[model samples]
Target: MTLLAAVAVGLAVAFVSLGAYVTVRQQMYRNLDDSLKDRAVQAANNGVLTNYYNLQRISSDALGLSDIRVGVYLDSGQKVNAKLSPLPPMNATELAVARGTAPDGYSIETVGTPNSPHFRVVAVPARFCPREDDQACDDGETLQAALVVAQSLKPIDRTLHNLGIVLWAIGLLGVIGAALAGNAIAQSGLRPLARLTAAAESIARTEDLRPIPVTGSDEITRLAVAFNAMLAALARSQDRQRRLVGDAGHELRTPLTSIRTNLDLLAQADKRGGLRAEDRQQLLDDVRAQMDELTTLIGDLTELARDTPQVRDAELIELSNVVEDALLKVRRRASGVEWDVQLSPFPVWGDERLLGRAVTNLLDNAAKYSVPDDTAGHRTDGEPLGRVTVRLLDGVLTVTDSGPGIAEADLPHVFERFYRSSEARSRPGSGLGLAIVKHAAEQHGGMIYARNAPNAGAQFTLWLPHAATQSR
Candidate 1:
C-alpha cells in the first residue's frame, strides 16, 4: 500500500508539473510572438518595403527590441537591401511567403552564422507601390514584397529554464511529502496486524492458548476473532491430552507392578533351588495373565490415541458380518455365556478392521461384566449374571447384556478416554475400550450411545449411516 501510494503521488505531481510548465512556456512564447508581430506591422506601415535605403536604416531603435533585424524581399525572391542582412539568408519557406504561396506568416528559425543564436521570424506580404493619401493598391505581381522581422529568443528560453527548475523543486518536495504521508498511513493501518503477530508469538513462547482481545469491524477483526476461537479449541484439546496421559500412567502402574512382583517371586524361588512344579506353574500363569493385561492396556491406549483413524483404508463393509465375526471371537473365550445374535443386511462405509474391532470391544465389554450361569441356567445368590443379546436392524446395531447396568451418573462419561465409574474400578481394563468404540463410530460417520435396558442391564446402540447414502 505504501509503495502504491507513493507511485500515485509521483504521477499526480508529474502531470500537474507538466501542465503548468506547458501553460507558462506557451504564454511566454505567445507574448514574444505578439511583440514580433507588432514590430513587423510598424515597419510595414513606415513604408520600409517601398525604398531599399529605408529598409537598411531599420535597426533596434526602430522597435523597442534589443536583438532585432528587418529586411524586405520582392516577388522575384531578391533581397531589396543587402546591407540590412543581420539574420540568415531567407530559406525556401520565406521565398514562398514572398511569392504569396506559403501558409506560415511567423516561424522560429536559426539566423546569422551557424554558431550564432536562434531567432523568431515573421513575414508579411505588402505592395511596393508609391505612397498615397489612400494606402491601398491592387494585388499586382510587380508590387508584391514580404516585410521580414526577426527577434532573439534567448530571453524567453532563460525565463522557461528558471520556471523548469522551480517546477522540478516543487515536484520533488511534493513527492517527499507524499512518501511521508503514505508511510504514516501504512503504519497506522497495520498496527492491528502487528499486535496479532505479537500475540501469536507470545503463545508460542509460553505454550498458552489464551485468546487475544478483539475490537473493530474489519477483516483484521474477523481474523482476530477466528484466531481466538482456534486458541479456545486448542486449549480444550490440550486439556484432554494432559488428562489422557495422566490416566494412562496411572492405569499402567497396576499391571506393571503385578508383573514385577511375580518376577521377583520367581527369582526368590529359583534362589531356593526351585519350587514344586505346581507352584511354579501357578506363578508362571499369574505372570502370563499380568503380561496379557499389560499388552491389552497398551493396545487400548494406542487405539484411543490415534488422531487420524479415518486416514486408514476404507471399504464398503457388511456391518452384520463384522458383528458376527466379533461374536465368534468372543465365543471361543466365553465358556458358558449364551449369545443370542440376530443379524441382517447392514452395510456401512468405513475401515472394516476398525469397525470389527469396535464390535469386538462391545462384545468383550458385555462378556467381562457377566458371570457364567449355573447348571439350571439361572442366577443364584453367589453366581454372577451371564447372557448377551446382539441385534441389528437397518443400520443400527445394539448389544445388550444381563449384567448390572451402568450407574446413571456415569453414563454421560462412558465414552471418555480412561474414564471408569466406581462400580467398574475392580474390573481389569484400561478404560479405553468404549472410547475407541466411540472414535470408530464417529470416524465412520456414525454414533454410539448407551442406555439402561427397559427391564434388565445396559444396552449399547451404534448407528452407522448406510453405505449407499454415506458422504465421502
Candidate 2:
C-alpha cells in the first residue's frame, strides 16, 4: 500500500509540474510578443521612423534590444536607410507588409549568424508620409513603409528550462514528503492490531485466559471484545473437563479398591481349603491382574486431571533421578523384565511424584507389550523377560525396549488417551499410560514422541527446556 501511494503521489506531482511548465512558457512567450508589438506601434505613432537614425538609437538604448537588428522598408519595397547594413532579403510575407498589404502582428522565425530562433513584430501604417495640411490621410496620400522589430528568445528559453527543473525538484520533494506521511498514517492506523498481538502473546506466556483491554470504539475494539469472550468460553470448558476427569477418577477408586480386596480375600480362602489348588491360584492371579489394570487406569485418569500448570509449578525435580526411580519401580512390579538404567543429571521444573509416575508408565507399557514368553528361553523359570533401557541426557529422557515396535501408522496417535495398537489390546494395562506421559511433559513445558528404533525396537523420548528449572 505504501508503494502504491508513493507512485500515485509521484505521478500527480509530475503532471502538475508539466502543466505549470507549459502554461508559464506559453505565457512568457506571449508577453514578450505583445511587448514587442506595443513598442512597434509606439514607434510608428511618435514618427520615430521619420528620423530613422533616432528610431534606431531609441530601440537599442531604451528597449534592451541592443543585439536585435531593426529594418524599415518604403512602400516601394525598397530598404530604407537604417542603423544595420546589408539586411537579408525579405520573405514574401514581409514584402507584402512593406507594400501595406500584410496584417499587423508578430511572426517567429530563425535568423542571425548562428541561425538562432527569433520573434519579429511588424507594423504597417496606412500612410507613412502624411500630408501636414490634414490630421487624417489625404486623398492622394500613398501607404507608408513597414517597420519590423525582431528579438532573440534563446535567453528566455533557457530561463524557462531552468524553471522547469526547479518545479520538478519541488515536485520530487512533495512526493517524498507524501510517502513519509503515508507511512506514519499506516502505522497509526494499525496500532490497535499491534496491541492485540502483544496482549495475545502475554496471555500465551502466562497461560492466563483473561479478557483483553478494549482499545477504541472501532471495529478493532469489537474484535478485542470477541476475543475476550472466546477466552472466557475456553477457560470454562477446560475447567469442566478437568473437573470431570477428577470426579470420574474419584468415583472409580473406591470400587477398584474393593474389588482388589475381595479378590485377595477369595484367594486366601481358596488356598486354606486346598481344593483344586492350581486352578484356584490361576483364578486368583487373573483377578489380581484385572484389578491391577483397573488401578492403573484410575491412577492415569487422576494424573491427567491433576496435570496442570499449577501442579507442575509446585516442585523442582531432577529428571535423571526420576527415571532411575521409575526403572526401579518397574523392575519390582514386573520382575521378569530386564532393566538397563543409564542416568545423568537433568534438573527440570515439575512435581517429582508426577514425573516419576510418567516414567513408570512408559516402562510399564514397554514391559507389558514386549516381554517374551518362557518358551523362547528369554525368561527364566516362568519369568517373562525383555530388555528395557532408561536414559537421561541433556534435559531429555528416553526409554527404549526390545519389544514389537509400534507400526509407523500408529505412531502419531499413540499419545492420545485410550489409544491402543490392535496387537496390544490383549495386554493387561490401560492405554492411557503414554497419554499421561504426554500430559505430564506438556504441563512441565516439554514434549514427548514415540518412534521405532533402527535395530528392531521402540523408543520414547521426552524433551524439556533447561529454563523449566528456573523460576516462574
Candidate 3:
C-alpha cells in the first residue's frame, strides 16, 4: 500500500512539475524574445551601432541592456559584429532577413564551439537611404542592411536549474509524506486482523471455545462475528457430546444388568443339580432377550456416534425402489397392523443402504406407536382407526400415521439423539432411529419436519431436492 501510494504521488508530482517547467520556460523565452525585439528595433532606428557600442562599453546594465549583443548584416555583403559581446555566427535565418525573405522575430542559435553557448536573437529590416537633416532614416526606401540583436540565455538557464532543484525537493517531500500516510493507514486497517490472528492463535494453544467481542459493522467486524458464532456452535456441540455419552452409559447399563442377572440365575440353577427344563429354558430366553436389546442399543449408539453418515459409492438411484425394499422388511413386522404404502418412482442421489434404513425407521416408528383395533372402525385410543399414509410427490416423501401424535413439549426434541419423552419411554427403541433419519436427511441436503395431523396422529414430511426426475 505504501509503495502504491508513493508511486501515485511521484507520478502526479512528475506530471505537475513537467507542465509547470514547460510553461515557465516558454514564458521566460517569450520575455527574452521581447527584450531582443525591443533592442533590435532600437539598433535599427539608430543606425549608429557605434553609440550603442560605446553605451554597452560603459555600462550595459545602466542602459537596461545587460549582456545584450548587437550586430549588423548589410545586403551588400558587409558584416559588423556587436561591440557589447561577439554574437553567434549568422546563419540562414539572418541571411534571409538581410535578403528580405524572412520576417523579423526571434531565433535561438548556438554560438562559438561545439559545446557552445546559446543566444536568443531578433532581426529587423534596415532600409538603405541617406539620412535626412533631422537624422531620421527613410522607411519606404530599398532595403540595405538588417539589424541583428542577440542576448545570452545563461540567466534563464540558471533560473530553470534552480526551479528544477526546488521542484525535485518538493516532489521528494510529497513522496515521503505519502509513504508515511500509507504506512499509518495500513497499520490502522490491519489492527483488527491482528487481533483476530492473536485470538485464533490463543485458541489453538489453549483449546478454548470462548466467543470474541464484535465491535464494528465492517467486513472485518462481520468476520469476527462469524468467528464468535463458530465458537458458540462448538460449545454447543461439546455439550451435546457430553450429554450423549452420559445418556448412552445410562441406557447401556439397564440391558447389561438384566443380562448379567439372568446369567447368574442360570449358573445358580446349574450348581443345584440342574434345574427344571422349563425354568432353564425361560431363564435362557430372558438372557437372549436382554442380549438382543443390548445389541440393538449398541447398534443405534454406533450409528449415532458416527460424525458423518456413511454414504460410500453414492449414486443416483431409484428412491422408490429403496422405499419398496424397506416396506417389504417392515411389512412382516407390521403384518398385524394396517399398511397403506403409496410408492412413487422418485430418483435421488444417496447411499442406498443408508436411505433404506432411514425409510425403514420411519415405518417402524409408525408401526410401533400404532395401536391396531380388533375392529376396523375402533382403536384403543378411542379414535377411529386410520392407516399410515405414505406418499411421494415431486421431491417430497410424506409419511403420516394415524397414531398418538408427539406431545407439544417433545415436538422440538424428537430428532435429537437419545432423546426419549416420558410418553415414549416404555416403547422398545434406543431413541436413535429418528436421529438417524434426521442425519440422513441432512446429509442428502434435504429437510425433515414433523407436525401433528389436523384430525389425528402425526405427519412426517421429508423434502429432498431433485428427488423426482425432471420431466422431459
Candidate 4:
C-alpha cells in the first residue's frame, strides 16, 4: 500500500513539474524573442555594421544595446560584420529575408552545440543604412541585408536547470510524504485488523472462544462479524460435545453396573461349588443382553457424535424402498403390533445409508410406542391390538402410532439428544434414536415434525427434497 501510494504521488508530481517547466520556458523564450526583435530594428536603423572596422573599439553600451551580438547578411547571403562576438549562423530564413522574397518576414532558431552557450537568434529584413543621408537606407522598396540578432540562452538554461532541480526535490519529498502517510494509515486505520489477528492468535494459544468486540461499520468490521459467528459455532460444537459426553456416561453406567453385578453373582456361584444349570443359563442370557445393549448405546453415541455430513456418495433412491426395508427390519421385534403400510414411489437425492437409518429409526419408534389398546379392551392373547400406520407419498413420510400420544409439554423436545418422556423412562432405549433421525433429516435438507393425532397417538412426518438428476 505504501509503495502504491508513493508511485501515484511520484507520477502526479512528475506531470505537474513537466507542465510548469514547459509553460515557464516557453513564456521566457517569447519575452526574449520580443526583446531581440526590438534590438534587431535598432541595429538595422543604426547601420551598426558600417562601423565594423572600429567595432573592437566601440562598446555596445554606447549604442544603448546591452548584451546583444549583431551580424549583417547581404542579399547574396554573405556576412559583412566579422568583428561581432559569436556571430549567429545564417540559415535559409536569413537568406530569404535579405533577398526581398520575404520583405516583412522574420525567423528565429537556436544556434550552437550543447557544450557551448546556445544563442536565441532572430533574423529580420534589415533596413541597411550605411550613411545617415543615403537614399537607399530610408527607401522602403529595397532589401539590402538581413539583421541577425543573437542573444545567449545561458540564463534561461540556468533558470530551467534550477527549476528542474526544485521540481525534482519536491517530487521526491511528495513521494516520501505519501509513503509515510500510507504507513500511518496502516497503523491507525487498520488497527482493528491487527487487533483481530492478535485475538485469533491468543484464542489459538488459550483455547478460548470469547467473541471480539465489534465497533463501527466497515469491511473490517464485517469481517469481525463473520469471525464472531464462526467462533459462536465452534463454541456450540464444544458445548454439544460436552453434553454428549455427560449423557453417554450416565447412560452407559446403568448397563455396566448390571453386567458387573451378574458377573459377581456368577463368580459367587462358582466359588460355592457351582450353581444349578438353569440359574447359570439365565445369568449368561442376562449378561449377553446387557452387552448387546451396551453395543447399541455405543453405536448410537458414535452416530450422534458426527460433526459434519458429506453427501459425496449420495444416490438418487426411491423413498418407498427405504421405508419397505425399514418395515421389514422392525417387523420381527414389533410383531405384537399391527402395521398398516401404504407407500408410493418417491425419488429423493440423499445419502442412502443415512436416509435408510433415519427411516428405520422412525419405524422402530412408532412400533415401540404402539402398545396394547386397553381402551378398546385388551386381547386375551396378550398381543398389542394397537396399530402403527406408515404412509409415504411424493417426498413425505408419515408414521403414526395408535397407542399413547406424546404429552403437550414434551412434544417440543422429543427429538432432542438424551430426552425421554415420563412414560419412556422405563422403556429400553438410549434416548438418542429420535435425535439421530432428526439430524439425518436436517443434513439432507429435509425436515421432521411430531404432533398428537386427533384420536390418541403421536404422528411423525418426515419431508425430503426431490432428486436432482442433473447431478448424476
Candidate 5:
C-alpha cells in the first residue's frame, strides 16, 4: 500500500510538472513567432519591398537585416522583382500565401542553393500595380504583384533546441524531487499503522491487554483507542472468570469436608457393633453444623456471582457500623478469645447485605486464626494469649490476629480459592472467607491485601472508595 501510494503521488506530480513545462514552451514559441512576424510586417510597411530594384546598389548598407531576399510576382505568374541572390522555387504553401489564400502565419521550408532552413512572409498588393494607375480597387480585386520576404531560421531553431533541452532537464529534476517527497510522505503516514499492527500481534501472542499509546488525532489514533478499549474489556472478562472459579471452589470445600467427616464418623460408629444415643447426638450436631456451613458458603458464593450493578443499586450505609456488627457476631462465636475493636464513621456505596458479608468474612478469618485455648493471659501450653483486632476507619476495614502468622510463601495465596495456610488445614473453617472479602472489596470499587504484620501476626486490609455523602 505504501509503495503504491508513493508511486501514485510521484506520477501525479511528474505529470503536472510536464504539462506546465509543455505549456510554457508552447507560449515561448508562439511569442517568438509573433515577434518575427511583426518585424517582417514593419519592414514591408517601410517600403523595403519597393526598393528591391536597387537592392544591389544598397544591399551592403541596409540596416537591421543582415541578409534579405525579396520577390515580386505578377498575377500572370511572371517574376517581376529580383534581389542579389537567385530566387528559390515557390513551394505550395508559400505560393498559396503569396496568392492571398493562406492564413496569416509564417511558414518554414527549405529553399534556394544550399537548401538550408528558411522562413517566408508573403504580402499582397491592394490593387494591380501599374497595370492601370488611377482606379479604386475592390476588396476582391486580384493583385498584379505579391511581395515575398524570406529569412534564414537556423539561429532561432538552434535557440529553441537549447531551450527544449533546458526545459527537459528541469522536468526531469522535478520528477526526481517528487519521488523523494512521495517516499517521505508515505513513510510518515504509515508509521502509525505499523505500530498498531505490532501492538495487536503482541497482544495476540501474550494475552496481555496492555494499552497501546496513541500519538495523533488521525484515523490510526482512533483505531488504537478502539483496540485498547477491546483489550481492557477482555482483561475485565478474564478477571471475572477467575473470580468465579475461585468463588466456586472456596464455596464448595467446606461442605465437602463436612460431608466427608460425617461419613467417616458414621463408618466408625458402624464398626463399633451398635451406635449409642450420645454418639448419635454428637453425629447429629456435627451434621447440623456442616449443613449450616454449607448453606452459608453457598449464600456467599451466590452473592459473589451476582452482578455488581444490582449490588451497587442498593442503599448506602455506614461501613463502620457494619464492621462493628460483624465483630459482635464473631465475639459470640469466639467468646473465650480476647477482642480488640476500633470503629469510626466510614460510609460506603453498596448493598448492606454484601457489605455485611464482607465484614463478617474478615472478622471470621481473624477469629478462626486466633489462639484456640488461651485462658488467664496464656494458653494451656503456657503460650501467650492471642487477640483478634477489627478496625474500621477512613473507609478502610482491617482485621489482624495475634496467632501463628501466615507463612511468607502462603501470604500471597491466602485469598485464592481453597488455599489455606499449612497451620489452617486442620482448622474448622473454609478457606473462602478471605476470598469472599476480596471479591466484596472489588465490587465496591476497592481492593483487599493480606500480609504478615511487623509484630507477630497476620493483617488483612480492605480499602474502599469513600461514599459520595462522605466526601467531606
Candidate 6:
C-alpha cells in the first residue's frame, strides 16, 4: 500500500510539475518573441532599414532593450548596418524573407560550442527606400529587405532552470509525505487484525474459547463477531465432550467393580476346592449378566457420543417401515410381553440406519418396561401384563408401554444423557435410550416428547418433519 501510494504521488507530481514548467517556458519565450519582433518592426519603420548609422543607438537606447540587437539585409546581399553590424549572418529563412521567397519567420540560434548561450531571432520583410536629392527610392522590388532582430536567451534559461529545481524539490516532498501518510493509515488498519490474529493463536495454543471484545461496527468488527460465534460453538462442544467422558467413566465403574469382585470370588473358590454346581452356575450367571449390562451401557454411550449426522445424505423413507422393523426385533427379544403395533405410510427425509437405531431403542425401552415381574407366568399366558403399543401416522410415531408411568419429577430430564430415575436404577438397561431418541429426532428436524397415557403407561411420541433440515 505504501509503495502504491508513493508511486501515485510521484506520478501526479511529475505530470503537474512538467506541465507547469512547459507552460511557463512557452509563455516566456512567446513574450520575448513578441517584444523582439515589435522592436525590429519599429526600427524598420524609423528609417533604420535605409540608414544604419544609428543601429546600435536605436537597438539599445531607442528600444530601451540593451540586450537586443538589430540588423537589416537586402535581396542584393547589401547590409544596412554594414559597419555597425551587431547580429549574426543572415540564415536561409531571413534571406528568403528579404528576397520575397518566404514569409516572416522566427528562430533560435546558439554558438557551435555545446554549452553556448542561445538567442531568439526574427526576420520580417519591408521596403528599404533611401532618400535622394531629386526623388526617394520607390521601386518596392529593388527595395526589398528584411529587418532582423536577436535577443539573448540566458535569462529565460536561468529562470527555467530555477523553476525546474523548485518543482523537483516540491515533488520530492509531496511523494515523501504521501508515503508517510500511507504507512500510518496501513498501520492503523492492521492493528486490529494483529489483535485478532494474536487471540486466535492464543486460543490455538491454550484451548481457551474466550471472545474478543468488539468496538465500532466495521468489516473487522463483523469478522470478530463471527469468530466469537465460532468460539461459543467450540466451547459448547468442549463442554459436551467433558460431560460425556465423565459420565461414561462413572457409568462404567459399577459393572467393572462387580465383575472384578465376582472374578476374585471364583478364583478363591477354585483354590478352596470347587464349589457346588448350582452355586458355581449362579456365580457365572451373575457375572455374565453384569458383563452384558456393561456391554449395553458402552454401546449406548457410543451411540450417544456420535456427532450430529450428515442430513444431506438422508433418503426419503417411510418412517413406519423403520418402526415396524424395530417392533419385529423387540418382539423376538422380549417374548413375554405382547406387542400391539399400528403403522401408517408416513414419508420423511432421514438416514435409515440412524432412524432405525432410534426406533429400536424406543421399542426396547417399552418392552423392557412392559414385561411382568414374574416372567415365567407371563410367558405361559397366566395374567399377562399389558402389551407395548406402537402407533405411527402422518409424521408422528408413538410407543407406549404398559408399565408404571414416568414420575412427574423425572419428566424434564428423561432425555438427558445418562439420566435415570429411582425406579429405573434397578432395571437392566442404560438410560441413554430416550436421549438417543431425542437426538435422532432433532437431527431430522423433529422432536420427541414423553407423557403418561390414560392406561397408566408411559407414552413416547417421536415426531419427524417431512423434510429434514441440513445438519451442521
Clashes of each: 1, 1, 0, 0, 0, 0
lDDT of 1 at 175: 79
- Cα RMSD, each candidate: 6.9, 16.0, 5.8, 5.1, 12.4, 6.9
lDDT of 5 by residue, 1-472 (tens): 4456556655775676668667765775566556545655665455544343343344522645445455555445655434354453455555555566667533544454545555534344312333233443354553544555555556656766686777667666666666677678778877899899998999889877879888889888898899889889888878877877765776577677878888888888789875788988888888887888788767766665664533446566888888778877877776556788888997778878777888888877776667653242234554435688777788777788887788889978988755777788777566667777877777777899988878878899999888884332
Per-residue lDDT over 219-287 for candidate 6, one digit per residue giving the tens place of the 0 to 100 score: 888999999999999899889989999988988998999999999999999999977899999999999
Rank order by lDDT, top first? 4, 6, 1, 3, 2, 5
User: Candidate 3 — what's its lDDT?
Assistant: 0.75
Error of 2 at 277 (Å): 4.0
Question: Regarding lDDT, does 4 or 6 come out ahead?
Answer: 4
Cα lDDT of model 2 by residue, 98-137, tens digit: 6756654333343444464544434444235433332444
Residue-by-residue lDDT tens digits, candidate 4, 1-472: 7888888999999999999999999999999999888877766666554333334445566766557676777786667553535566777778887876765587788887878778898888765544434333346543477878788899999999999999999999999999999888778878999999999999999999999999999999999999999999999999999999999999999999999999999999899998899999999999998999899889889988985754566778888998988889888777677888899998887788888888988888887788643333234477666789988988889999986899999999999999999888877788988998899888778889999989889999999888863243
Model 6 TM-score, 2 decimals: 0.62
Best by lDDT: 4
Q: Where does candidate 6 stray beyond 4 Å?
A: 1-179, 309-316, 347-349, 371-377, 467-472
Q: Rate the local accuracy (lDDT) of all candidates.
A: 0.78, 0.70, 0.75, 0.82, 0.67, 0.79
lDDT of 6: 0.79
Worst 10 residues of 2 by lDDT: 126-135
Identify the runs in model 5 with alpha carbons over 4 angstroms from their true place: 1-274, 307-310, 373-385, 469-472
Clashing pairs in 4: none
C-alpha TM-scores of all predictions: 0.62, 0.46, 0.74, 0.76, 0.47, 0.62
The better candidate by TM-score, 3 or 4, is 4
The Cα error of candidate 3 at residue 100, in Å, is 7.8
Error of 4 at 276 (Å): 5.7
Winner of 2 and 6 under lDDT: 6
lDDT of 3 by residue, 206-232 (tens): 989897777978888989999999888
